[model samples]
Target: MMAGTPSRNELHEQNRLSWNEATKAHNSHKGDQAKFFREGGSTLFPEEIELLGDITGLSLVHLQCNAGQDTLSLARLGAIVTGVDISDEAIAFAQKLSQESGISANFDRADIFDWFEETATAGKQFDIAFSSYGAVCWISDLNLWAKGISNILKTGGRFVVVDFHPVAMIFDTDWSHKFSYYSRNRKCTQ
Candidate 1:
């Protein structure tokens, strides 16, 4: 809480609005998710599949599941999957994709910070908390994100995060080592 900074609610609302717009743009630009699934395509990479290693009958929670492509893929692999995203458009598209793909999954539109409490109130817990590229950067507070994951997971649960190094993205900017690269504990603005 800063003297004049936007509140968490305000930040969430801002993110929601931006992601809602991004969903429309993504759905339009990216090849149809439903079409890809209907044609036997999976949004999951081989490494994630190997890491997940047989999710049959397991409960999975996908945080920042943009359009639920990977979430539905997990469902197709027999995991009871629930996806949470900040964008209503993304959730709606995911629901439609589920219907079109004839796969079963649940989609929720909520900020990641509220995920644990919301799912807890619904009496839902999961065996895994999954996220992939581009999701971690959306998190302004890592502690809250960690707490959310912890609260949502059952015993022996796993948290799987697969993404490019943030430093690599920095390199993508100007190909220079001007900025100091550090480990995860310290926070750095991009």
Candidate 2:
């Protein structure tokens, strides 16, 4: 099993470390959102979306949302969506582009761990909570992640996660082993 997740302090530090020049990249991607969404734009894939059935009238919270693409996409689907991410610059760009596209959403900046811990709520919560494609490997605590989702989710709320495990191999067996281990090691895990 993997190690226990780092403390909130450590995660915050790492979030900062990971965001260097990331703003520039997110900003550039905003230019191509139209083309991007035509492809994927972090939204639900056609198959997984079908599994969601109808989200036409639910309140949803999207965590670690990059550039707010998926969050806005959900809003387009009629879910009241909020986008949260650790990158301040990314959140800002998300807001700007969202406004540009006439999509309305609340965007906030905070580490997911810290945000969940700090945002106290009463009996109310979102109808659904989601994170896709770009979550998971960014953190180390699946238990805590589940707990946080549970906290912000209403009774029987649905939580969806879509992402690839960095360590997952299509075929790691000896059969048809064509690539060198060194090549896989040199590939970008993120």
**Best by the lDDT measure:** 1
Model 2 segments beyond 4 Å from truth? 1-8, 29-43, 122-124, 169-190
Please, what are the lDDT tens digits per residue for candidate 2 over residues 56-123? 88888888886787788888778888888887777877787687767778888877766777654444
lDDT of each: 0.83, 0.70
Candidate 1, 1-190: lDDT as tens digits:
5598677678778888888898898889776667788888888999999989989999999988988899999998999999999899999999999999889999988777777787777777899999998888768778878987888889899999998777764453668765555545433211
| Residue 51 error, candidate 1, Å | 0.9
Q: What's the lDDT for candidate 2?
A: 0.70
- Runs in model 1 deviating more than 4 A are 171-190
Q: How far off is residue 83 in model 1, in Å?
A: 0.4
Error of 1 at 110 (Å): 0.8
What is the RMSD, in Å, between candidate 1 and the native fold over all Cα? 3.1
Task: Give the CA lDDT, 0 to 100, for residue 123 in model 1.
Answer: 72
